[model samples]
Every structure is written in C-alpha cells, then in structure tokens.
Target: MRIRNSVIVITGAASGVGRATALHFARHRVSLVLASRRVEALEALVAECQALGSRAIAVPTDTSEYDDVRQLASRAVQEYGRIDIWVNNAAVSFFSPFLAVPMADFRRVIDVNVMGYVHGARVALERMQDQGAGVVVNVASIVGAVPQPYTSAYSVSKAAVRALGVSLGSELGLDRQKHIHVCTVLPPTIDTPFFQHAANYTGRRAVAMPPVYSPERVAKAILRLAERPRHELVVGRLGRSMVRQHRLMPGRMEKVMAHQVENTHLSKKQAADPSSGNLYAPSLDPATAQVTGGWKGRRRSARRTLAGAALLGVGVVVLADRLRTART
Candidate 1:
C-alpha cells in the first residue's frame, strides 16, 4: 500500500471530491490518470497536479460508456506500465420524487452513477487481476445506507455501489486474491458542486444538507484507504452517527430521514425551473470544476455544528428509548 510512486486512476477527476483527491495524491509523488467528460477541467487538473510534482494525464471519458472506461484503463497502463489503485468516483444525480421524475433522467442517473462504477470496477479489476495486486475505491454516500425522501434514484444507485463493493470483496476473498482489494467510502453531505450540477425536478433548488464536510476531508479518507484498504469507511462524524442510528432503528431512522430531506435537503425559499443540470452533458462553465461549492461560510459552519450536535443528541435519545422498550 505504499502510495509513493504508485499509479492511480481516478474517474470524475474534473471536480468536487475527485479533484480534491487528485491534488492530495499528487503531493505523494504518485502517477495519476484523471478522467471526466470535461476535457478543459481535466486538463486544468492535470496541470495543477503536475505543478504539485506528480506525473499526471487527463483522459476525457464518459464513464457510462463501457468502451470509454475500457480505453481509460488501457491508457493508464500504456502510460504508467501498471495500475496500483483505481478510484471510481464518477457519478451523476437528480433531485425528484420517485414518480415525478422523468424515466429518462432517472435511468441516466443509474447509468452514470451505478453502471459507471460498474464499468470502472470491471475494467480496473480486470487489469489488476493481471497485475495480481491493486486496490479499487468506490465512493458511495450515507444516503445509500439510509434512504432519503425525494432523490430516489440517487439513493438507489449509491446503495447499489455499496452492495457492489461488498460482493466484489467477498468474491476476491473466495478466490483467495489477498492482495486485491475493493473499498467503499460513505461520505455525508459534502461542500461540493454536486448540488448545483444535479438534475432537478422538485421545483426547488437543491442544497447540501447540514453538517456539510469539506471535500478535502473525503479526499483524506480516500488517501488513507489507498495506504491501508478497509472494507468500508464512513467520512464525517454526523455521517457515522446517522449510519449507526439507521442500524439500530430502521423504521424510526427512515422517518427522520424523510423529514430531514423534505425540510433541509432543498432550498425552501427558492424555486428552480426544471433543467437537466449535468446528467447528460458536462457543464461548460469553468466554475463547475472547482473543489469547493462556497458552502463553507463561517455562519453556516457554526449553524451546521449546532445542528449536527442536536441531531446526534436526538439519535442517542431514540436509541436509549428503544433499548428501554426491549428491556421492558
């Protein structure tokens, strides 16, 4: 797991957590193959990584296409001679009620989010099997474990990602491929452009939920996984708390999540006209490729801190009541 000098392949490398992760590994002297649909953004990220002293290249890729992903892996090996780690981070989402969402948009989300990861894993693992050693990190979400109210397709896709990691890990173990590993990372609401880029149909502007952590934090977790692979890692304190609550009280947690999504996941004061954000095409705006989403202001940070603490307290009380009932 020595990351220094390792060759890493990252999808969705143009923006958000993927961008942050690329910069992080660049500091460690790793060779990087960055992929995304935005050629301009990917080229910019490659320049930045090169400035940071890493050997890097940008591959314009639409991960939903199996051929594009296959070529990406081939390109990585062609350049670096070997793939040490493959990170499946490319994903798209939509904010809509289950029935209200257009079938095409929902399917697009699945294609880019779920099948995108599938293609990445399949190609990455195929190459890794030939090498006989490599790690694959799948970026999932906390919503995967605890479903939200409106973003049904997103939740389903993320849950499928988690399941895919588990199944892949089990198969590797069964086949006795000890050196090959698949890791899943579950992060909470992150300060990223994902909210702005997601296709919206709820008639409201989407927003990152409270207690939003920085993309850099998730990048650090991913870096740790590359150094020491684990089956699953949950980023952020609030995310871990929510996952624990869901495990303890499934019915109650679902109710709480529904309320949370309805009240806070979207802007109550602002209305949005329906538009496909970046599901079908990458955003042309240069601003869409940055690392942070301007969501980490001081006031919002303070508010999120208080909100997270309150939610954690409520979870504790709910679990205590459940335990008491069991005893009775």
Candidate 2:
C-alpha cells in the first residue's frame, strides 16, 4: 500500500506507540483518522499531524465499544472516501496475581485489549471489502506468546489478540480476500505510558519489563507493515529471541520470564493502594502519552539482560549435566 496520500485510521492515537505511529505516518503525508478516549490529547495530536501537512481528524473514541469503533469507520469514510489502512493499537493492562485480580478489572482488560481489536477489525474489514483493498494491523505483544507472572489479564488479552489476527488472516485467505491484509505485531516490553496506565496490585511502583525498546521502533515496524503486510512480525531483538528460545525450551523460557517479571516489572519503592489506573477512564494528563514512560532506574535494562543471560547459562549447565548422567 502506498502511504503517501493514503487514508489511515489508528486507535489509541493519543499516546505511546499509537502516537509515535501516527507521527511516523504523518511524515508520509497520509490522511489520518485518530481515535482515543483522551479528547484533549487527541485534539493536540490532530493539530500536530495537520501541521505536518497531512489531513487528520481526532475522533474521541472508546474503542472497547463497538458503536464507537463503527462510528470511527463511518467518519473516516465520510471524510476521506476510503480507508487504506487501519491500526488497532488501543489497549489496557493489569499487573496482578491471577487470583488477586478483580473480576471487573480482568474483564475490563479483555474488553479493551481483545474486544477492542475485534471491533476494529470487524468494521475495517466490512469497509475494505467494499473498497476492494485495505490493511489491518493489530498490535499484540511478545507476552502474547510468552506469558509473564503477575500479568495474567494483560498476557491473556494479548494472546487472544494474536489469535484474532491469525484467525482473521486465515479467513480472509479462505474467502479469497488477499488484498485485505491482517498483520499482527508482537512487540517486547516498550518504554510507553502503558505501565503508568496499567492497573497494579503488587503494592510497588509499576515498570515495564527489561530490554525496553523505544516506542518509535515499534511504530517504524508498523509503518513498514502498512507498506508490505505480513501475517506476523516480532518487533524487538530480545522479543524475537525470546519467541525462538521459548519454542525450543518452554520450561526454561518460562522461568526466565518469571524471573524478569518478579525482578524488573515492579519497583522496590513502596507504592499506593491498587487502583485501576486509566482502565475505566481516559488519562487526563497529556504527558501520559509521551514516547517514553520516564522510568529511569540505574542500568535497569542492563541488569535485567545480565540476569536473563545468567538464567540461560544455568539452564545450559543443568541440561549438560543431565545429558552426561543419562549417557553414563
């Protein structure tokens, strides 16, 4: 798909990966239909994109609702005749034990992360079928493939999202709708506002897992996918490696992820009571949408990476020992 002069719709456009992606596409001079719950941030982004010499509109939307997503599609077509690309990037996260997480919080995470993508895909496919071509990019996560501890709701929702993309792609192929592409992006822990907005129950300050990539990197991959769509893409080096390692040694990889989750995903500093941050409502702070989540602990990523390497080393030694014993 030619990005220049194409019309694209992006959900969760107010901040983080979505915002970075929007700016990236804006550089290509594509018309943009931006949607997010934060009206003020959305409006500000609209102006920013417009200043970049692209036609853009901000539609304050809660993507968890089918109606809101449907309306977004209608508005995009109404303004730009057709949509060439649609990106499902709206999502929420919950960091808590599986049993400790409230049912309401869990349900809300599923609604936004899983159902939100479903609504976007359903509406985009309908319009694209009539138009005879379009691309749908779903932003899933490596956590979808490799679930982590204390993030049951978030991991499950992401896993479902990845499945949704695979199923949709298969169906589209079966229906001979090759021109309408469904691509899934499985990114590693990114430095985004997602941690700030995630509902936390660990009684510690929330932080993303280590080896965090800049949101711009994921945004760039998404832009590339919009140009040449693939069935699935893993964004970061660590994330891609994790997927391969998990495939080869599931139990060992699980232990590595659990170690990272326990040591990296939470701050040692004491935090306030558990609250569903931005799960039920939009974040009012414009700063929440910044590219970086402002998590600056001393060499956190380096330390975590070293810890992961140590775990891998131990696993290899244990395996070698087991093999020697079996041979003897």
Candidate 3:
C-alpha cells in the first residue's frame, strides 16, 4: 500500500522504536496519530512531525485500557476519513527472577505489553474491516521466540503477541479479508530507552545487550512492513540467526540464551535499587523520550558483531556434528 496521504496510528510514540517510526513516517506524506502516556513528549513529537510537513496529532493514551484504545481509533477516523496503518508498539519490560518479582509488577508487564497490543489490534482491525483494507504491525521482541532468563513476564507477553498475530492472520484468511494484513516484527536488543525505562527488580542494572541495533533500524523495518505486509519479520541479522538456531536446537539454545542474558543483558558491576520504572506512570525525564539510548556505536557494534558471529558459528558446527552422529 502507498504510504503517502495515508492515515497511520502509532502507539508508544513518546520514545524508543515507536518514536523513531513516527518520525520516519513523518517524512512521507502521511497523517499520523501518535499515542503515548507522556502527554508532553507526544506534543513535542507532534510538533516535530508537523515541522516535517505531515499532518499529525498527539493523543495521550494508555493502550492497556480498551476504552482508551477505542477512543484512539475513533479519534483517528474523526481526524482522517479512514485508517490505513496501525502500529502496536507500546510495551513495558521488567527484569527480575520469576520468584523475585512482585505479582503486581509481573501482571503490569503483561497488562501493558500483551493486553496493550490486544486492545490496539481489536480496535484497529474492527475499523480496518469496515474500510476493507488496513495493516497492523505488531512490534514484538526476539525473546518471544528465544526466551531469556530474568525476564519471564516480558518473554511471556512477547510470545503471546506473536501468537496473537498468527491467530489474527488465520482468522482473517478464513474470512477472506485479503486486504487487511497483520504483521509481527521481532527485534533483538535495540538501542532504545526501553532498557532504562524498564522496571528492574534485579540487583544489577538492565542494559541493552551486545550487538544492539539502533531504534532507527527497527523503525525502518516497521515502515517496510507497513508498506508491504509480511507475517513475521526479524529486524536484525543476529536476531534472525538466533531464531534459526533456537528452532534447530531448542534445548541447547535455551541454555545459551540464559547465559547470554546473565552476562551481557544486565550489568555485572552496576548495582541498581528495585524500582518500577514507567510501568504505572509515564517517565518524567525528558531524556527517556528520545529515539536512541546511547548504546549503539560503530566500535561497539563491530566488536559485538564479531562475538555473535563466532558464537553462532560454533553452534552451527555442533548441530552439524550431532546430525552426523545421529545418522551414523
């Protein structure tokens, strides 16, 4: 579908990948409806989009609430005659051992990450069905496919998001709704404020792991999916490789991922106090509203890329040897 002059709604537009996506679409001749809990940040983003020569509005929304999502959809149609694309990108994460995390925090992560996307999809699909054409791009994490340690709730919510995309696509297929498409994007560690904004119960600080891709990269991938809908897209090469390895050796991959998360995903030296970061309330810090989290750089990317390649190469060789032994 042509992006120009189309009406696009993006959730979590205040920061991270969502913010980057909004700015990206703003370059095209598209009307944007930006949603987020941070009213000030959304307003700022709206001005930026407008400056880029796009028609845009800021809608302060809590996507976990069905009524809020419904109003968001209504507002989009009220502003623009029709909805063309809906991006389900609003999500929150918590880093903690399963037993250590409070039940409330765990539920909040599910509510915002899983139920938030559900609310957006429900409202977006209904409106799109009426129009007979639309696209829903769900931003899930690679952890959805290859679960990591210390983030059980986040992992579960992302996996549910992936499942939601599959079920919706199948239902649409059965109903012959060929024009309305649902696409799921799975990104690995991304250089976004997501790590800083996450609720952390682990004693160590949460960090964007090695080989972290820039938010802009993920944003570009989201734009591509919106223009040409695909069922599933992994944003990074390392992420795609990890997913394939997990599929080939689930048991071994789980152990490897656990180790990776423990050593790299969380800071080993930096201690952090337990706090519910942006789970219930919007982040007050202006710094958290930017697209990049200062984790991506040429030197870091190159080093991490080499490390990841070596690890994947060893895994491939081990898997090949196992296959040969089994054949013998």
- Winning candidate number (TM-score): 3
Instruction: Please list the C-alpha lDDT of all candidates, in the order they appear.
Output: 0.92, 0.87, 0.91
Candidate 2's TM-score: 0.94
Better of 1 and 2 by lDDT: 1
* lDDT of each residue in 293-320, candidate 1, tens digit only: 8788223677667877876777888878
Segments in model 1 whose C-alpha atoms lie over 4 Å from true places = 297-301, 323-328
Model 3 TM-score, all chains together:
0.97
In the range 179-265, model 2's lDDT, one tens digit per residue, is 899999998877788888888787888887677777888999999999999999998656777887788778888888898788777
- Candidate order, lDDT descending: 1, 3, 2
Q: What TM-score do all the candidates reach, one by one?
A: 0.97, 0.94, 0.97
Error of 1 at 155 (Å): 0.2
CA RMSD for every model? Answer: 1.4, 2.2, 1.2
Q: Candidate 1, overall lDDT?
A: 0.92
Assess the local accuracy of residue 62 in candidate 1 as a C-alpha lDDT between 0 and 100: 97
